[model samples]
Target: MRIPFALAALTLLLGACTVSTGAEPEPTQVAGAVCDVPDDLRPARPYRIPQDEVAADVAVAFNMLAVSWSPQACRSGKDYPDARYQCAANQFGLTLHGLWPNGADNKHPRYCAAPGPAIAVETVRRHFCMIPSPSLQQHEWAAHGTCGWDSPEAYFAQAAKMWDGLNKPDLEAIPTQRLTAGAIRDAFVAANPGFPRDGVFIATTDGWFREARLCYSRDYRPMRCPRGLGAPDRERLKLAPKGVQQDAQRGVQTTG
Candidate 1:
């Protein structure tokens, strides 16, 4: 007999529900579900998805495709089968405004209601956190396309971990002063040795630093970067409060 599709889907959602396993943090607990995940969003389990691979998820479960711009506001792609989207749809290609997507000129009658946009927001949010297109389609499609987890708890836990990992990297309190790019990189590789070699991490770093430069007019990427990836770029590597790189580099060794 075929296993129920829901059971199969559930299997995909869980890391190893059937296997004998040690108790672990729920996705909500580990991911910081409560604050980051809205009430209407799904909760996540403390699943260990890779960092670089998290952002590309389409998160269309909000059924945004079910809604489109006015016919005039949309354009066809160069060819068929790839499909067309709203004139403002950033998915078509590199957009002038980046992914700061423009609003659709119209909304579907079904989605004009409150839950509609909420769902859409949730769908889009997954893309922000690195939920790539395929994973979103496979795991999030039937769930109404929200970019969040199964429960608020899971969402919050995941959020918490992400926030801590990104926003504050003392390298397990090893102190940032003595942390050279090489040392920090070593520490980072030690902690996450299994991470795949991919450009997404670089992309995410670029995104983070770009945002930092835009927001603070200063290099704030290290504040949120993991130690390994935190090695300062030659041009902007200095994390010194006094804007003195060599001095700060020396201080780390003195303290440690």
Candidate 2:
């Protein structure tokens, strides 16, 4: 299903938005020097999946660019209205869904051990408007973050860098009239020079566009989507109305 950042100090450190519909996502704002990605970090490389494996094996994902539902949609009048998630959704639009790590086969590693929480609740408060929630932060770290980094701080710092580097399309500008998924994917390809056309995937419910995903290689470079992700480019697609309320558990799956 749908899935799942930062460090503070030797003794203490860890913390972390909100998502708005039809609005541009806010830039991540993190305080302290630790928030930056290390200059020496090595990037993951990409390779084409073998044809034989493509059919029998599960889709492989190195990293992904995902958008999440607004806090009001996820928490408003719900059994558990997470104040932190709501706070974040209110401040940001299309917040990061997750950065997942997967293999070519069915095996996917998740919820790995972490030395401690990725970010403290207070640190989470500092970037509440931009980050999704504390639970998401921890889940992402324990599941996907551990595969890419040794500590939550390093993983979060890199995530910030990835978000910063993305040349995402403007979802706010999606045309309301009849459109094809190809047109939607093209919008993204136009914005991101190196991004592959087949790499963009869509997720929706009853013709309402819920989220768009962008796949990346291990080294953080764009690559062709293996299969079974978004709609075919030529297929007709629909976008949800502006400010559309999403299901409470939006982004429950972590894969790209």
Candidate 3:
């Protein structure tokens, strides 16, 4: 499936741009992720993106780095065919959701402009490892990128740079019993010294780990979230193990 033509047109007119951890314990040091780009990958299909209150007109307050737990995202969408590339392999751990610009009082900008041209196929292929979904990447560019960036390339480049700068914790190594929202936050702070203790905002779905939204300054320095978003500190969390095929099908398990 291809992105809608209207969205594509908007994209052509404007290009542009665009997570967490805890520390109760020192998290296990895992090797950096190695993404195996798929040779047969295709562009994402059309997906609806909800409109929001503001657009490019809103003053940029702070930035947000949204990261999703791949297993949870995949498991939830396992029945859908579009999800195959990400869900079928179960090779991903955390993945980029998007970089967002926020305004005061919880009002964020979105769908800043109509969709322009479909994102360049090469651009989609380039970041497929980081986002895993072509449609999502395209949607992000249309919904949020237009507000802050002049082009798709610049938007994605900034997102990739921020994503690369992060030191992610290995969730698979943590015992389930210790996986509370606060524990996850602490692990992130431990992994990156300058990161504020309240910087990471844990998001969950039915108690399962969802996304981690980390707050940042306009210049991208770590900053405390204005108001904690998503699950609370003491909330118990569940996560599907990384790279385990069966775990993806059965959902998250509590095992040490």
- TM-score leader: 3
**Which regions in candidate 1 have their CA more than 4 angstroms from the true location?**
1-27, 31-35, 39-119, 125-172, 194-256
Off by over 4 Å in 2: 1-61, 69-91, 126-129, 242-256
Q: TM-score of the candidate numbered 1?
A: 0.23
Query: lDDT scores for all predictions?
Result: 0.24, 0.51, 0.69
- Better TM-score candidate (1, 2): 2
For model 3, residues 61-167, the per-residue Cα lDDT tens digits are 99999877777766665312135556554267778888988777656777677667778878886777677777677777877788889888899999988886786
* Global local distance difference test of model 3: 0.69
In model 2, what lDDT does residue 59 have? Answer: 41
Q: At residue 150, what lDDT does model 2 achieve? A: 82
Question: Model 1 Cα displacement at 79 (Å)?
Answer: 33
lDDT of 1 by residue, 1-256 (tens): 8999999856544421011123531222111111122222232222223333333334221111110111111131111111111121212111111111112222211111112212243433342222212222222322321243444234334432333333212332344545344433433335444422210111112211111110100121222222132224322222212111111111111000
Candidate of highest lDDT:
3
